[model samples]
Target: MGRVLSVNAREFEEWMQRSLAACEAALDGFVPIDAPVGLGVAMRYAVLDGGKRLRPLLVLATCEAVDGDREAAMRAACAVELIHAYSLVHDDMPCMDDDVLRRGKPTVHVQFGEAQAMLAGDAMQALAFDVLTPDSGVAPALQARLCALLARSAGHAGMAGGQAIDLASVGLSLDEATLRDMHRRKTGVLLQASVMMGAACAETPARATAALAEYGAALGLAFQVVDDILDVTQDSEVLGKTAGKDQDANKPTYVSLMGLEPARALAQELRCQAQQALADSGLPNTAWLSMLADMVVERDN
Candidate 1:
């Protein structure tokens, strides 16, 4: 079984490399290397050549797993990434998390000035919808659904709302349930949407869709749990960002709230839940998703 898992992992890694290459090309084309002026440069800077691109990978992988339209999936993948990038651009501003390093480089607000970063984030959000609701290619109904899902995930009831909770909870005691709820909005919702959006690219059945949603939710929570663990265990250089920043900011995290060992256990449990969801998904050959679950937990950065 270990040998079989290794072989499967190798195959999925190859697939992920190819998909990442394709995603890079697509993102480059959508968010051009050049724009009209300074704002254009900032937009490109915030998005191009940074970060893990995990969300986009989820989109494409789920698309393939569901036998969806590759072209449409690529579009959705890039769109979701744009939203992620925008959030980071804004999140690093002085008003928000106020960080200087991201993806091992200067944060957008630091690199491009706060105003430019803000504008770039705004533009990127608009561009996400533009990419989704193109004049041709993807079906109109599907486009609408994708647009709606992205909006909800990125809007008040999702990532934005979670951020609000995070800002408010700093220096305040939060119960496990409240912390979990906050992460479900801030991080998990978008991740969940990535899977659902990919499923939407094809004619997935209701059962497969539900199972994928479960997998995505578990994976999302696991991602945050690992992030919290890395915040304590890894250094700034290894993490490509400020390590222990969460603790410094007085922000509540899995590690801070539940302790390091328990947080680690929670991540493993979430990983198991994610894998179980995939098994129950009844979808054929979810090797990529399974590998991604492990990668999210095992990654140091």
Candidate 2:
């Protein structure tokens, strides 16, 4: 039902590069450089540079797809990214995953003490909402919608809930259905919310909104499936994080539950579902969304 464009790989790459640059610049400006006791420094370190910025890209792509407000989309993009960064900061703490490296650099806890890292995460989580509710340009109604979408995705019902399940499931053997539910909450909801928040920036048809929701859900799960695959097949230097850590922690991942080849197949299947959802969205320009789905499944890192 959608209008398909003749987009090639080169064009998609150029668009991705431009989008990523804009996101990085916006994040650099939005994340503060000053807070009491060097808190700002740690926050900036955790958010400013590194990582794929997939969530922001999804927000921007969906905004463009919906012909939404660019200003609102940018703010939503940054807000979702801030929440993701905060989660990573907390997840890498000594009591959590106890990771030393993230994004190919020492984790916030490693570089800045544990207390500072924890505080940095807390600040970033609060800052995400602050970014959403700006004084001007964005409408109050849109602000509230964006805030609500973000809060639901990051709160107990979404990412935090998933994390709790992850922590508890460590060393426990979770079946495929249970693992899917956990990842759907922990990793998938926020990504899905990114798409929804972007769509919220403007008025969209109910049909398109529903289709995009399906697209986001499929794409989010595909991303995590790829992550599980990369964890075992790739190395620390390649992954920018400790490789095999999931296995080391005995965490139940798609790769663990379904086997590596089957996990890879599932990622491909999910990518197909995401593309089909976009096709069903009936939007004129969803080339970026289509390409991003491919990127998520095919990405090496």
Candidate 3:
């Protein structure tokens, strides 16, 4: 059993600020401003100026861990964020979660009409791949690998498949195993793919890649568990989204299934698992990854 080393809080905060600034700039530069019919505005609205950019940070951090190519990692970071943003757009629509608020602002469908929001999501999804497959800088082979990883994670086998299960399972009793499976596809895969994509930016060894995958999976599940906890414990103003929506919708969550204290315990357990994976990875610089795992589980909103 491996252990998580202590991370300097001030150092982590400084790194986070720098990484976030870079990611925001990359996203703004990559997302176009000249699409026809006001589409560019909606696309930018959905992607820019909101959210924690956790996925992008994960991509960048893992890339640093492996000493990977900064250009490819940055592209991958922006691409993953695009996929995540697109998913949030569609997920908040009337046909889905029907959310009216996201990231403390009106949902995309509310800001833009539902039809426009739909198109924005569609365009962002396409643009994710476009960001990955630039005409220059990134090698063709590396581009292909990054695209394949993102596509599979965002496609039916990953996020979409998990969402399908989620919609159908609403108001239904889901055992722990079934619930885990649903979330693993819906949320975990993308987060895991972020790590793998970063690793792909350079020639990471097999052992390190495997360990990072394990770390990503554990951190992803831990993220959702903490989210469930926040839904019940935090309010909308604090959470920046609808609070208690899961319980209101009769959706099964870790908190609903296992009670609040147990769910909290589970989150800590998963965080430990993530830290253990990082320790096992044999990569020298995993301070950021370890701190991220802590941040995922300990986040207030």
Candidate 4:
């Protein structure tokens, strides 16, 4: 087994930059520009190039941690990103959050009309599965597994269900447990799926898989906690989205339930749990996962 090696921030940053570039190229190549006029353009606009690409990065990182197939991991990374982009498109519509900004630019609904934006989201979701269940490359069994993973994570029991709870909880005071549950479904499940999907692409041991799942859960929760903190502390320019919108909308968040300092502490605690889980995993090389846990907490955006 390859032993875990300590990687400095600069080294990891360079690796991440390169991985992101490869992921971007794959996305560009996978998401086609068809002749549907506005719909095709809107789909491209929604998915082509934007956002932090955190889900894809998680997929790639977890795959690397497990010594998974690089090609499968790359496809998994791009597939998860497509689902995320679709979610953002629908989430920013006038019927939902009604936001005008995303990834430091106009949301799809704002750039394209609401109708085209909806269609774009719908098409991108279909394309996500298409990218996963390709005619060749990945095995059919793995394709089925990946499809199931992506669907469950993005569907009602995961992101969609969480979003529903979020809409229902606006202006209502929620306790910490309820808030965490909501975030787990809304944000955490998909992140967890990213890690799990990566492991599925490889021959990871059951014990190590369980440990990675735990790490993904902790890291996902930490990610949301940090996002809650950033919403309170950062500006629109820095955050790429409208800052303080959660507060303005009276959405119950980590910072809203606990103070900023406590919320920050909660994020750190989760990060530590993630690192501990990685350490528990018998997989020799967990350095990437550990570094990613830190990045989840330290990220400003």
Highest lDDT scorer: 3
Which run of 10 residues does model 3 get worst, by summed lDDT? 1-10
Candidate 4: misplaced stretches above 4 Å? 1-4
Q: Looking at model 4, which ten-residue stretch has the lowest summed lDDT?
A: 1-10
Number of colliding residue pairs in each model = 0, 0, 0, 0
Off by over 4 Å in 1: 1-7
* Model 2 vs. true fold: TM: 0.98
Model 4: per-residue Cα lDDT at residue 274? 89
Per-residue lDDT of candidate 2, residues 76-188 (tens digit): 99999999999999999999999999999999999999999999999999999999999999999999999999999999999999999999998998998899999999999
Cα lDDT tens digits, model 4, 111-164, are 988998999999999999989987888999899889999999999999999999
Cα TM-score of candidate 3: 0.98
Model 3, residue 24: what's the lDDT?
95
lDDT of each: 0.90, 0.93, 0.94, 0.90
Task: Please report how far candidate 1 places residue 249 from its true position, in Å.
Answer: 0.7
lDDT, model 4, position 76: 92
- Model 2 residue pairs with clashes: none
Clash count, candidate 2: 0
Mark the regions of model 2 whose C-alpha exceeds 4 Å error after superposition. Answer: 1-3
Q: How do all models score by TM-score?
A: 0.97, 0.98, 0.98, 0.97
